[model samples]
Target: MWQQKTIHLAEKPRGFHLITEEVLAQLPEIKNIKIGLVHLLLQHTSAGLTLNENADPTVREDFLQYINRLAPEDLNYLKHTYEGDDDMPAHLKSSLLGVELMLPITQGQLNLGVWQGIYLGEYRNFGGVRQLIVTIQS
Candidate 1:
């Protein structure tokens, strides 16, 4: 049997953070086990996942700004009440955005584009721990 561990993204993200490949790398395998699918789920309500540019920092900044503009924080929608104004907007942002993403795995790694990088989008004002579920299969 082959098994891997979950990597926790511990931060309230504003941009893309390049995680080392060693974290997701599986151990030595005696037999062949092809990964058919990858499931990445964001545990928090205000956070989501997106595969975006990994090469340029400015691109990520621009992306973040763009998403924020798409669903600006200060919109006056009183559907979901919360402690702070950003809370409801955050959920709304997630709704406008998404929660989970599916990526195909090839060569024992995530088959992301050249500039694409996996990001855990956090709309919160401060840092918090976000758990990602990575399930690999044949």
Candidate 2:
């Protein structure tokens, strides 16, 4: 059986530029770690995932600003009135941004590109807990 851990995403009205290595470290030990696949999924609809440049904080900031400009909080949006203007934009951001990712694991670790990292893109105003399902297979 594979191992699992639930990551509690911090309240990020401003979005999260986080590293996922900590979560991966929690997987069960396996031998002959020749080939494995890691699957990640965000439990919230308003949140998403992106595999992007990890070396430069500027890259993360640039990407985040770009997305917000692409999908700004619309006061004119109706659905937002209920959850606030950020509501619809959150869904749009999540949609335009996306969710779920499959990573290739090699040598008992993830084979990510140089300067690449996994981030939980939270588009909501109030963030409390987000669930991440991690599966390690041999």
Candidate 3:
């Protein structure tokens, strides 16, 4: 069986947010899959997706810190400054992270580790509603 759906996440500030529950809330059909894979693709260039530590909020802050250092907003080398100073850096962060994630589905639920969860790498200051194309194969 194969199914696909698009989920629009609420707008968020520039940071990493744990959104595993939010995604699952929109995908009630996941319970029908006894064994399968869930593929998620973020339809945005200024944002990203990742799976990481969800128990501690500091992990997210650390991610933001390291990534900002990796792609500082004040770099004079950036040319894509039409949007704002944060736009180019946001793009860099998006590329540095990623836009897609694939996870195993077992017994009608996501087979994530005890400390693992989905993360929304909101790179833009006002990224608006993020879109995620979810595809499931059972």
- What's the TM for model 1? 0.76
- What's the lDDT for all of these models? 0.62, 0.73, 0.95
Q: Which stretches in model 1 have alpha-carbon errors above 4 Å? A: 1-6, 13-35, 79-81
lDDT of 2: 0.73
TM-scores for all candidates? 0.76, 0.84, 0.99
Candidate 3 ranges beyond 4 A from true positions: none
lDDT of 2 at 49: 89
Candidate 1 per-residue C-alpha lDDT over 112-136 given as tens digits, one digit per residue, 9 for 90 to 100:
7887776666777763777766555
Question: Higher-lDDT candidate among 2 and 3?
Answer: 3
lDDT value, residue 38 of candidate 1: 60
List model 2 lDDT by residue over 1-138, tens digit each: 455555555455557566566555555453346687777777877888889888877887787788889888855645554676777777888888778888887887778888789887877777556777766666
RMSD of 1: 3.4
What does candidate 3's lDDT look like per residue over 41-131, in tens digits? Answer: 9999999999999899999999999999999999899999899999999999999999999999999999999999999999888999999
